[model samples]
Target: MFKIKSEVGFDMAHYLCGYEGKCANIHGHRYRLVATLKSETLQESGQCRGMVDDFTNFKKALKEIAEDFDHKLLIEDNEEGRELAAKLEVLPNNFDIVFVPYRTTAEEMSRDVFNRLKSKGFKIYEVELFETPTNSCIYTEE
Candidate 1:
């Protein structure tokens, strides 16, 4: 098998709506997102010959995906979250809010990345999402 990896970084804030911990309050992290792709056969011809995929294309697409989450507030798409987003939108702070389908935890973030890359037709094998330098979540299919 052949595999390649690429990574990008972003900063974002989030709050768990119903959690009972310090993380329930709004917080931010310097997130690191890593994407890995694997293939049993490499491209045998053309510009990508002998490679699983082009690194430039992989990194570019990953950056585009990460760009959406950069410098934004992630709010889960729930009733309370929707209301909060609306309130923030009208505020003078000019908050950038991103409505995510699930809680903005590292685990969910990794899963979200995997799905997003998969939707782009990448041979996505694993996603590693770092909420901090020492803490991370890895999402992959069994």
Candidate 2:
């Protein structure tokens, strides 16, 4: 089996709704997102003659997706958080609201990104999401 990986870093802010601690409040983090691709065969000849996969296109697409979330607020399903996000969406703040289908955690974030990228026709095998420098989560699709 051959595998290739690409990594991109971005920053975003968010507060978990219904949390009992400081995480319930608004906060931000310099997030890191890593994407991995795998394939069993390599092209015999072409621009990627010797590579397991062409990462240039992959990286470019991933970067574009990351750009949308960069410097945005990632709010989960908290009423207060949604209210604040709604109000902020109309303000001068260039806040981007991402309505996640799951809880706002590193784990969920990775899975979300993984599914999105896959839906976009990228051969995504694994996703690593970093919520903090000391904490990160990974999700893989088998």
Candidate 3:
């Protein structure tokens, strides 16, 4: 199989409610997302002939995904988080909030990004999300 990978970066803040660690408090990260796509065959016609996919298009999609989270507060769509979000909305400083179906963790983010790209018709092989320069989480289908 042939595979291609693209990397995108964004900045965001999050907190794991009810956790007993420093991460339970709000914090930010310079997040990095790596997406991999795989296929057994290459295109045989058109501008993409003999290529897995256009690198430009792949990077553009990744960038769009990254932009969605850039400069935002990512949080779970729970009662507490929602309430906090509602309160924050009225603050003088404009804030961006991204409510996710799951907890705001690197592992869950990887899985969420993988599913999103897959739904866009990409043959996603894996998604890796870096919470720190040395820490990362990867998600892939078995």
- Which candidate gets the maximum lDDT versus the true structure? 1
The best-first sequence of candidates by lDDT reads: 1, 3, 2
Model 1 segments beyond 4 Å from truth?
Answer: none
TM-score of 3: 0.95
Candidate lDDT (C-alpha), each: 0.92, 0.81, 0.91
Per-residue lDDT for 125 in model 3? Answer: 95
What is the TM-score (0 to 1) of candidate 2?
A: 0.85
Ranked by lDDT, the better of candidates 1 and 3 is 1
Encode model 3's per-residue lDDT on 1-142: one tens digit a residue: 8999999999999968667877777899999999999999999999999988899889998999999999999988999888888888899878778899898989999999999899988989999999999999999995
